[model samples]
Target: MNIHLIAVPYDSAVRGWRMGAGPEALLRSGLEDHLRARGHHVATEIVEAPDDGPATEIRTAFVLAAALRDRVRTAREAGALAVVLAGNCGSALGTVAALAEDEPLVVWMDAHGDLNTPETSRSGFLDGMALAILTGHCWAPMAASLLPRPVAEDHVLLVGARDLDAGEQALLADSAIRLVHADAARAECRGCWTPHAR
Candidate 1:
């Protein structure tokens, strides 16, 4: 299999800080070499926002998304699997946008639900609203333009979300996205759930 490793080395629009350092660190740790040893052909690219202005969390995030979307599209057209290593979960927006025509299922595994809207996000952290944007729960105009169509909630599975805010919890309860607790996932190894939908 041909694999494209697309790295976005920025966290909250800042490079080389906090989670932003992760992608480079993983590269330096020789992840590409390890994958090559497994016999899969690998290629790498780093997505970067233009240095035209000061970086703000939200604006630069979308800029990065657009850049990533193009790169992912190019990789897919070349029949390579695009593996995105991103500092923030919002990078999923770019990936999904590139594959929107395929109507892919989304499996989101995170300690906290990335389900907050502008109205409910106390921290104003754009990353917190990533999944919400995908589900059309917030940032409607921008998300719609990027995603082509809203992803069906039933096609999304939010797993290991133990740190949900009240608003996120309420939204999850109302959404069709499957919520799988980390504990429940462990039990699944012992046949806690059948493959059939519940």
Candidate 2:
């Protein structure tokens, strides 16, 4: 299988993961070699932020968004079958928007539903509002980058989700996402000694 790895490296404003170290840790945890050993061609790229990139909160979103916009576009055009945009959901969402040109089938695998809009977001973190933007529920500026259209709410499925934020629950009720809570999705999979809970 062909894989394009787009790294996000943002950790919300949680005070632990915004440092861009997340990608390094994944590499250290054997992401590249393990995939190559399995006969997958894994192409790699990073969301390049300045060493002195803006440290302010909201501006950080645009800085990160600009970086991700370029990275995902460059990687998407490199000609891969599947692109893995992994890491902080904030940057990941921007990458997905950039890649919406591919007419993607987005499988959002996460613990939280990630369906919060900026207006509804109690936390005000971009990470929490990623799914809402992708669904085209809000975020006119960000969604505008996804030429032709945004990922349809119907085509964007969710799995491995056990928890739901209050905002997410409301959105899910009104939205068309094919949300499979972790247990049900696992139980529905065919013929595996151990189901892929992740």
Best-fitting candidate, scored by TM-score: 1
Q: What is the lDDT of residue 117 in candidate 1?
A: 95
Candidate 2 steric clashes: 0
TM-score of each: 0.92, 0.74
Model 2 stretches astray by more than 4 angstroms: 1-4, 13-20, 33-43, 51-53, 80-85, 146-148, 190-198
lDDT of each: 0.90, 0.69
lDDT of 1 by residue, 1-42 (tens): 999999999889998678989998898999899999999999
Task: Give the Cα error of residue 145 in candidate 2, in Å.
Answer: 3.9
- Backbone clashes in each candidate structure, one number apiece? 0, 0
**Which candidate has the top score in lDDT?**
1
Error of 1 at 197 (Å): 29
**Compared with the true structure, what per-residue lDDT tens digits does model 2 show for residues 46-147?**
665555744655456546676676666776566665454445676655666676767778898889877878767887767677777777777767556543
